[model samples]
Target: MMKTKKLIIVGASGFAEIAHEYFDADTEYEVVAYAVEEEFLKTDTLNGLPVVAFETMHQRFAPQEHSVFVAATYTQLNRLRARLAAASKEKGYALASYISPRAFIWRNVELGEHCFIFEDNTVQPFVKVGNNVVMWSGNHIGHHSKIKDNCFISSHVVISGFCDIGENSFLGVNCTIINNIEIAKDNWIGPAVTITHNTDVAAFFKPAKHEPASVNTYRFLRIKEE
Candidate 1:
């Protein structure tokens, strides 16, 4: 397929590379270049594409012709991505969203710009996904659930119906949010956590650290410790 719409990804990190791969393979947007802040600009090319300075990228790829996608992770509680996205828009670049063809999105689901929904994600009816939201693969966003702006939802999360995930929150991999739960803004729910009740603003929920057995595994299994 001929990809007519040009796209510039903001960032040169691993996540940015992944975003390039996804957009190139699945979407109509042809990722032409990668952009980063001048202070952090290192390589001239990433994934065979030119790595340009974000400050002056618009000069080469005019915002009127090219769109941008900020491929930042949950750094600084998603503030970095949000800031870059806002800056890109201020530069007159239209924010591009990528919804995987493999993902199942109900007709009533409302997805905002700059959002990235990966494969195997099931966004049911009445789900409202806000801008700059990143939903990794294999998540189930139930009916009437609202994932606010700038949130990063890791893989295999199960958000039940009527849940309200607040803005700038990071839902870790394998986390489960029960029905009717409201996760407050800036909350960090760590891996394997199960949230059953409403969370306060800026709440941090992490799974208990694993305690290894006192006996060595080699000794227990009667094997040599190499």
Candidate 2:
């Protein structure tokens, strides 16, 4: 049996905690510690492991012996995760990727490092997912699709075949992108929005909020008020 590799997660947020659970239970990586910026290092322990300061983490866990995964969300349009992953690489730590065992990834899919693919994600054939990308649960990445680096795809997103999602883009929950569409870099597509054509760089698309009806629930249902 292959020995499980020791890993250090870079972040102290909820995402880091989730990454710990997934890495510990599903992947071959054994999460040994959590690292955060010194200012945010409030507690010394998280999930029964040492929470070290990111600035001096190398002193404790040598980069040659441990790998790192930046467990950050789509903060600053994924710039934070990208920066931390780059920093971890600069510190001589190999970036770790986590593809859930429950995800259905095709044999020809080309996935890059530092990517976190959650459960129920279906990555079709010939898909190329770049580094520092995060795909949340239940996302469908169609055949021949290319997700560029630093992209964040939220839950239940659908990207049809031959789509090219550019770098640093964030696809919100339940958003749909049609086939052959090219989503430009740094785009922010809001939840439930459907894109039929290519997007410009840094484009922001949001669905209109549903307005509440003037009639109360009791009146709309013809029921007596409590």
Candidate 3:
């Protein structure tokens, strides 16, 4: 039988716990430890494993024997995740990728290292997902779409065919990128918004504010009195 590769997750927060669960359950990676910055190190243990300072984690867990996954969210515009991913590579640790079994990824699709593709994601043919990209559950990535590195796609998003999402972009939940659209780098697309064409670099797009309905649900139902 093939032995599973030991891994150290680069975080200790809730997202790191989720990454640990996914990598443990679906992949061949055995999470051995958690690593965070010295200043952020509050606890000594997480998920029953020793939490070490990232500065000296390499000394404890040799990179030649262990792999790493930066289990960080899209905070700081994904710049922090990108920086950590690069640092892990520099430390001679091979980055890991996790694709959920419930996700439908085509055979021809290309996924880069350190990617996290969650359940119910329908990644069609000819799709290329770059490194450090996070696709939350239930996103539809149409054919010929290319998601660049450090991009975070939220749940229920629809990226139609021939779309190109640039690096460090964040697409919020329920957003739709129409066919032939190219979202530029560092763009932040808010929830429920639709992009029909190309977007400028570092642009922030959000849906219009929604007002409360004048009639409540109880009033609209009009119940008959006895």
Candidate 4:
């Protein structure tokens, strides 16, 4: 078999570890090292690879030889990840995309550069996923949905058909967006929130807290004392 491209993950966090595992097992990119900011650089190695400083990573791992993947989470509404991805491109390194083999992507789906789609993501036909987008596992993206750039979708998000998710938006886990809804840019959707209609710019929707139970589970279940 031919040799695969070398990859350098620009993070050492939990998300980076997941990224490494997926890319190493499924993709043609071999993860050779990890890169982080100088101040945040704690250890010399991660996962048996050297943890290089992001400031001078290009010197050690040349852009022409190794590609980069910014394995940042949804920090600062994905602005930090977006910035790092852009910076890697500016440094002349190609950005790598990770699409899990377990994902079910329709042939008509259009995915832009630097995207990360985890396992069990069902992307329907005509779904347009923009650049620098990250979708966690088990998301059901319906047909004709348009997810714009720099969006971070958590696991189990159900986006119905004809929905448009705007840029720099963060969708938390277990959220559902109904059909034909247009989510605006910079929106922060908390877990379990359902969107049935269009939203304004920078909309923030969080689920309401439920009242605590008056009695314990044993009393509720009416179990006899042992």
Q: Write the per-residue lDDT of candidate 3 for residues 29-105, one digit (tens) a residue.
A: 99999999899999999878999999899999999999999999899989888898899889999998889999999
Clashes of 3: 0
Candidate 1 lDDT over 96-124, as tens digits, reads 99999999999989999999999999999
**Candidate 3 regions off by >4 Å?**
1-3, 223-226
C-alpha RMSD between model 3 and the true structure: 1.8
Question: Lowest lDDT 10-mer window, candidate 3?
Answer: 217-226
Which segments of model 2 are wrong by more than 4 Å?
1-3
Considering summed lDDT, which 10 consecutive residues are worst modelled in model 1? 206-215
Judge candidate 2 against the unseen true structure and give its global Cα lDDT, from 0 to 1.
0.95
lDDT (Cα, 0-100) at 54 in candidate 3: 90
The candidate 4 region of ten consecutive residues with least summed lDDT is 1-10
Candidate 1 residue runs with Cα over 4 Å from true position: 215-226
- Which candidate gets the maximum lDDT versus the true structure? 1
* lDDT score for candidate 1 against the true structure: 0.96
Q: Residues 45-147, candidate 2: write the lDDT tens digits.
A: 9889999999899999999999999999999999999998999898999999999989999999999989999999999999999999999999999999999
TM-score for each candidate, following the candidate numbering = 0.95, 0.97, 0.96, 0.97
Per-prediction CA RMSD (Å): 1.6, 1.3, 1.8, 1.2
User: Which clashing pairs does model 4 show?
Assistant: none
The C-alpha lDDT values of all candidates are 0.96, 0.95, 0.93, 0.94
User: In model 2, how large is the Cα lDDT of residue 185?
Assistant: 99
